[model samples]
Target: MSTPSPNTEQMTSQPAILDQTIGSRLKETVGQHPDRLAVKSTTLRLTYRELDEQSDALAAALQALGIQAGDRVACSLGTSIAHLLVIYACFKSGAILTSLNPSYTSQQVVSALRHVDVRCYIASSDILLPYKAPVSSSTLLKSVFAACDQDDGQVSVSSVIVVSNGAPNEQAIQDSRVWAFEGLLEAHRGRVVEPATKLHQDDTISLQFTSGTTSLPKAVALDHWSILNNANVVSHLWETTCEDVFVCTVPLYHTTGITALVLAAMLHGACLSMPCEAFNAQQMLRAVVEDRCTILHGVPTMFQAFVRLRYSPEFAAHDFSHIRTGFIGAAPIVSSLREKLNQQLNLSGIGNAYGMTETCPAVAVSTRKDPDEQKFYSVGRPIPHATVRIAARDDPHQTLNVGERGEVLVAGMLMKEYWGDPERTAAAITTTVSDDGIKTRWMHTGDEGVLDMQGFLTVTGRIKDIIIRGGENIYPPEVENVLMQCPGIESVAVVGIDDEAYGEVVGAFIVLTIGTVISLIEDTKSDCIDLRQTTGLQTANDASGSVVLTAAKAREWVRTRLSHHLVPKYIFLVDELPTTPTGKIEKHKLRTQGCAALAITGAIASER
Candidate 1:
C-alpha cells in the first residue's frame, strides 16, 4: 500500500537528496579537497587527487578492454584499496560494477556472475585460486576459469583482468586469456576518459548479491538515485566531513560497507581507512587508536570478536578515547551484548542501524545526538527522505498503531529490482496510487518491529522466525533477550523444535563466556552424572569439546524470566552460532540441527 501520503515537510524539503551520479559527484569532491586523503589501507594511501587520477587511468583501461556503458564488470575481490579503485573505475567508465567475495566457492562466484552476464571479469590472482583449482577439486572448473562460466549462450564474459596484491602475479596467472592489471594501467595512464554522458539517475550502477541465509541469494540491481543519494543523505545526517578519518571493518562487498562507509566517505571527502585487507579485531582497533579514526562501522560479529578479546594483556588497557562515533548492525543485537560493548569498551557514541541489502542497506539509524538509551536499544528514526511504518503482519493496507508489533514497510532507498527477476521484485515491492494521484512504492520487509511515539523503531524479530508454542506465539528475540541476562551465557540462538505433543517447542543454542562454570553445588542431595553422559546434553557438535554448563540451569534461568511455554524444552551449547558469509545468524540451519538434537520423549515434553 502507498504510504499515508508523506506530509508536506517530507515532500517539500528533499534538498538533501542529490540528483547527480556518484561518478560525477566524486570528481567534484576531488576538486574541492584535492589534498585530502580519500582511501586508505594498511599498506596504501591515496589523496583525493591521486584517487581521481588513478581511477581515471583505470577507467580508460576498462573501456579499452571493451567495457561499454551498461555492461556488467565483475570483480572477485574483497575489501582492499585495489577493490575501491575498481569501484570508481567502473563508475567512471559507466559499467555496472558487481563485487564477488573472493572466499566464496567458484560455483557460487560463477553463478552470480553468469546471472548478470558479466562482460568483463577483474580479479587479483590470489582471488583466482578458487576458479583455477583442479577439475576434480571444483564441480564448475571443468569448463574453464572465468570463461564459459555459464552455458555457451549464457556465458558473456569476454575477458579477464588479473591484478596483483603487491608483487608480480603474471606467473600465478598463466591463463592465455588473462590481461595483467599493471600492463593495462601503464598503457592507459594519462589518457582522458569521460564519464557516461547520458547516465540517468535510475540507471543501475552496482549489482550485489544478498547473503541468502535461508535460500539462494538474489542478485539485486541498485540505481544511482537510490544508493548514491542514500549515502549522501546519511553522510549529512552523520555530519561526516573532510576532517573525519573513518576507520571501517565491514567487508567492502556488502552494501553497508559500500554505501554507508565508502560512498559516504568519498561524498563528504572523509578518509575511508581500513586496518588491513583481512579482518582482525585487534588490528582494527589498533588502527582506530593509532590513526585517530573518528568514525568506525561494523557488523555485530566484528564487535563481538573484539569483546571476546577485550580482556587480553594487549587489549585490557587499550585506549579507545580517540574514537568519537560508530555503528552496530547487520544482525540482531541483544541488550546483553550491547551492554558489554557499552560498559567494557567505554564507547560513548556507538549506535544502531537497520535495513536489508535490498534497501541499499540504510533506512533507519540512530545518530549520536539521540539519547544513549534510545541509541542503544532502538534503531532511531527513518533516514532523511525514507518513510518507515509498521503494517499489519498479514495485511499491508492496514497500518498498525505506534508501539504495536507488525511487519516493517519502507518506501525509499530500495533497489531497482532483483536483477532480471521481475516476479520476485514485484513480490517484494508494492505500488499504490494515492487519492491525490501520487504513486509510492513500498517494500515489504519480512522483519517484525514497532515504532514508538518518539518515532524510534525497535526491531523484534523476523516474521519467519516466530515460534508457535501450542496456542501461544513466541518471538525468539524476546526469549533470547531473557537468556542473555543469564550470568554465564555468552551468545544464544532460539529456534522452534518439532514436537509431537505440542506441534513445536522452543530450543536454544548457547555459547558460554570465558571461565564460566556450570555448578551443581546447590544440588548437593542429587547424584552427579558421569562426564561421558552426553545424551542429556542434547548436543550436535560441542566444538568446545566440553560442556561447562548444565541444560537444567540454563532452562531454569529462562523459565524464571519468560513464560513457562516460552522456556526451551531442549538446549544445546554450541561452540559458535552458524552464520552467513556476512554476519547474520542462520536460524533455519539451527532449526534442522535442533530437530536432530531433540530426543525428547512424551514424558519430557509434558514436563512442567
Candidate 2:
C-alpha cells in the first residue's frame, strides 16, 4: 500500500476546497462515495470504488508502457467507460491529454497528431485506422495501447489492449503492449498510484484544439489552476449543489461539456447522466424525465430542438416537474427561443454564458433573478476572480465608457501562455506595470462588446463579424436573433453585403418549418363570394386563412417586431445553412453564398 502524503500548507491566495491537481481531488471523491454510482451507460455501471481501482491499474499499465510526466497522450475513443479510464490514467500519470474528435476525417486527424506530436495513443478497437503522428515514420513511441489484439509480450510498438463485453480480439490482444487492462485490475494490490513529482498549479494538464475562423487550429492549453478556479467560479455562480443532477449530452471533447458539466459535477458531487450515443432530443428528454435531472448544460441549438420537441402533444404527457435549472453556453440563444422554453417546458431560467476554451469556458453568465430586459440584452457580470474591461485597440489607456463597444479584455484566472506558440501567446496577452512596479497583464478576448452602466456585459458581436453599415456598426448576431423569431422560420443566419447607399446592409437566409405554403387559395368565386358565410371574419381566419408563409412572410413577421432599420432587407429560403465542425452556423460562408445569389437575381442596388 502506498503511504499517504502529509497535508501541505494550502495556497491561501488561491480558491479554497479545490486542489490544483483535480486527480487528487477526484480520488478523494472516490473515497467519499465509494459505493455511489460514478458512471453509468446502457451496458455499464461503475461504483466509485471500482472506478478508483481501475484508474490505479490503468495508471500502472501506462507507466509500464514508458509513459511519464509531460508526455502527450492522445485519445480518439468513444463515450464509453474505457474512454473515461484513459483520461483518468493520463491525469494520474501527469501526462497531458489531447482529445481528438472521433468524427474528424483521417487527414484532419493526421494534422492534429502532427501538430501535437503525441507520444502514445489509447484508441478504441472499433474505430479502424488509428490516428498517426505527422512524421513519415514513428520514433520514440514505446507502444500502442489499443483494444484489439496483442502478439507476444513484445516490449514495444503495435501492441493492442482488446476491450469488449464478450469475445476479445485475441490476435491484437496478445502483443506486449496489449496487456489486458481489466486483468491488470484483478492483479492490483489496491495500492494508490504514486507520482514522481507533485503537479504544479501552472503546469499544463490538457490541450484542447479550437478551430480558428481562418488560420490552422490553435491548441488551447489549460493548466490545473485555471481549470480548478473556473470550476469553482461556475459552480458557485450557478449554485450547483450536491443535490443537483446535471444532464450532460454534449460531446466530452467540447470545451463546455468538459469544463462545465463533467468537472463541475465532480466538484460539487452532483450526479451526472449522459448516454454513450450522441445527443438525441427525444432520448435526452426521456432521460431527463426518468432521471429527475435538476440541471441541464447544452448549446443553444440543442435547446431549440428540445423546445420544438416539447411543442408536440406527446411531449406534454411526460413528467418534467423535476427540472429546476439550465445553463446554455458556447453559442447565442434567441430571445424567442428562451421565451418559448419558459412557456412550454417549465425550465427555471436560461443562462447566456460567454467564454472560450482557453479560459475554462466561463467569463460571464446570466442569472434567473435579473430583469427580463437584462437577461435578454446581456450576458451577466463576470464570475468571481475574473476582471473584465473594454479597451480601444489604438489607446489601451482609454477605457471605453458604458455602451461604447471595444475589445474585451480579461485578467485573473486566465492561462499564462499557449503551448509551444510564444508568438501567439505574446499576441494574446498584454503586460503593464503598476505604480509599485508589480506587473499587470490581461488577455485579449478577440471579441467586441459593450458594458452597461451597471457593469453587465453585452457582447454586440465578434470583432470579425461586425458589419460597418456606413460606419453605423451593425452586428449580425443581434439581427439574426430577431429574424429567428419569425413565425414560419425554423433557423436563420444573417450577414452583411456591400451597398452604395449604405456601406453594407444585412441579408438573412432562413430555413422555414416544413409544410409551409407560399400561397393560400380559396374557391370564393365559385361559391358566389360567400360574403354572408364569411361575415364573421374574426373566426373565419383562426389559423387556416393565415397569410401565405414564405421567406418573405418571415421577413414581414420580423418587420412588425423590430425597427424598420433593423429588419433584414432580403430573405432567402435554404434547405440548410453552412455550419462549422462544432455545429455553429458559419455566417461568413453564408454571406458569400447569399451575395452570389442576390447578384444573380439583379437585386444588387446600382451605384446611387
Candidate 3:
C-alpha cells in the first residue's frame, strides 16, 4: 500500500456549476443572436434562427415517427451541415443522440448497433447503401426492419433515415421502413412540436462510445448538465466570443468536435465552419484563410500535417493571420513539435486539452494567455467545475503529493454512467473519503500523470503502457519524448514485448521523416544495401538495411538522454503507426506486431 499525502485535503475542491440542457442553451443563443452565423459548410450556411427552425421541424418529424424522450437516435454521417441539424433535432426531442463514424466498416457498424438499442439511425445515401442492398440478407438490418413492422414493446431500430445531397437512390427507396431525409424535412417543413417531457439538466443527452483500441467500445452515457457545463467552461477558457469563428476539422462523432468545438461555439454564439465532410489538411487551411476563422481544433497529427503543408509552393495562396487561438488533444504533443506548429501557423497561442470520452471531453485546457512553456509542457489546469488529483497507481485510495507520478483522478465533471454496463461503470468511478471526512466520487482515469503545485497536469502515459522490466516501471512517453527530438525521426511509439530474462522489454516502432538518408556501411553485402532510402518516398517501405541503421542511431540517441533501463531494447522501422478512428496511436497493436517480429528474427536476447 502507498501512503496518502498530507496535502490531499487541499487538493480536493469544488468548481462553479451551471444547470442547463443543450436544447435550452441553443434556444438562448438563438434568442440572443438570431442573425448570427451559427454553422457553415462548403455550400450551406445557417444563421442561429434558421438552424433552430430547421431543427424544430426535424424534431417534429421524429416525434411523428414515434421517437420520444430518452430514445436513442444514432447518426452515421460525415461532418456537415446536415449532421449538425440532426444533432440539434435530437436535442429538441429530448432523445439521446449517439454518433457512428462513417468510416466504420459494415461489420463494425453492425456490432455497434447490436451493442446499443438504437431507435432511429440517420445516415447519408453513401453510408446507407451497404445496409439497403442486402436488407433481407443482413441479420442486423432484417431484425431492425422486422421490429419496426411490428408494434413490439422491445427497443429496436424502427427507421433508417437516409440523407441525400442530390437525388435519392431508387434502390434505397424500395425499403418500406427506409425514408428519404429530404421527404421528412419537406413533410413537416413548418411544423414544430414540444417535447413530451420537460427538458431537465440531469436528463441523459448523449451515448458516446469509447475508441475501441484494445477491446470493444463501451457506451458512455453523458447528461445535459455535464456536457453543457463542460462546454461552457472550455469555451470560457478558450476566451471564445460571438465574433470568434471556429474551423472544425475533427469528426463530429468524437466528443472533441461535438462538446468542445460545436457546443462550445453554440454556448458563446460563435460561428462554426466545417471545412469538409472529413479531415483534410489543405481544406482546413483553406477554410481558415477563406472564412477568416479565429479558432481551430484538432489532434497533434492533424496540426503536424497542416504545418507540413507550409513547405508547398501554393502555401502562400492562403492567409493564416486571422487564426489566434486553438485546441490540440487526443494524443501527446511533444514540446519541439508544439514550437514548430506555433511558429509555422502563426497562432497567437495553441492550448492543449486533456480528458476522455466520458468527461464530455474537456476537463482541463490551457488559456490563450498561458506562457509558451506551460502550453508545451502541461495540459493546463482543470476547467471550472472540475478538479484533479494524482492518486497512487496501485492503491486508488491513496493520493500522492504534487510532482509525484501516479494515476490521475478527476471529480465534479463526469459521465452519468456507462450505458447499460453498471459493472464497468462502477469499476471506473469510485467513492472516496477525504482526510476531512467529506465523501466524493472521482473518475479513476487509468492514465498516469503528475500534478504541479500550480494545479497544472502533465500526463505521463497510460497505465497499460507501463513497461515492467527487471522490477522497474518504465513509462513510454518519457523515452518517446526524448527520441522525438532526435534527427530524422518523424513519429515513434514504444511498447513492451515479452522477454525471457526480464518479464518484459521495451520495443520502439519508428517512422522516419521523408528525405532522411541512411548511408550504407562499406562492408555491407549487396543484398543488405539500403533499398528503402529512395528520395521523395511518401509512404513507409519494408524494413531494409537502412531501417536497421536508423534503429541503431535511435538506440544511441536514447542512451544519451535516459537511464540504461529506460532505453528501448528493440527497434522496428515502419511506414506509419496504426491509429484509432480518433487519431490516437494504437500501441497495443504495435506490441503484438513487435513481439512477432522479434520472435521471427530470433533476436530476443541478441538485440540487447
Stretches off by above 4 angstroms in model 3 are 1-16, 128-155, 165-173, 211-214, 317-319, 434-438, 517-549, 603-608
Candidate 1, 1-608: lDDT as tens digits: 43232221232234367888888888899999999889888778899998888888999988887788899998876577778888888887789999777666777777776789888887665542211332122233323364574346576777788676644433453455568777887898787687546777788989888744447778888888888888887777677889988876887777888888889899888998766666767778777777788887877777888787788887788767666776788877877778887788766677788888889888787877778888667877787788887888888877787668899999888988888888888988888788999988889889988887667888888887888878778889878888988877878889888878888888887777765544444332112221213233233244254445656777788878877898887666667788765678889988886665444333355583
TM-scores of all models? 0.88, 0.82, 0.88
lDDT of 3 by residue, 284-350 (tens): 8778878898888778778877888986886756557777787888888887788888777776477
Ranked by lDDT, the better of candidates 1 and 2 is 1
Writing each residue's lDDT as its tens digit, candidate 2 over 1-608 gives 42232111111233454546878778777777777766666677777678778878787776666777777777765456777777777777787888877655555555565576676655554442112222211111212322112454222223334444333433343335545556655565365777677777677878888765655677888777787778776777667776777775666666676677767777766776766445667777777877688777777777777887885776778647677655766666677777777677876465678887767778887766556676666777777677677889666655676667798887766765676788988888887777999877777887898776666788877787777776777777767777776666678777787677987877777665654433223212111111122122222234475533544455566678676666676655566676543457787787777667666555434431
Worst 10 residues of 2 by lDDT: 523-532
lDDT: which candidate is best? 3
lDDT of 1: 0.75
Error of 2 at 315 (Å): 2.9
Candidate 1 error regions (>4 Å): 1-15, 127-151, 166-173, 195-197, 211-214, 517-548, 599-608
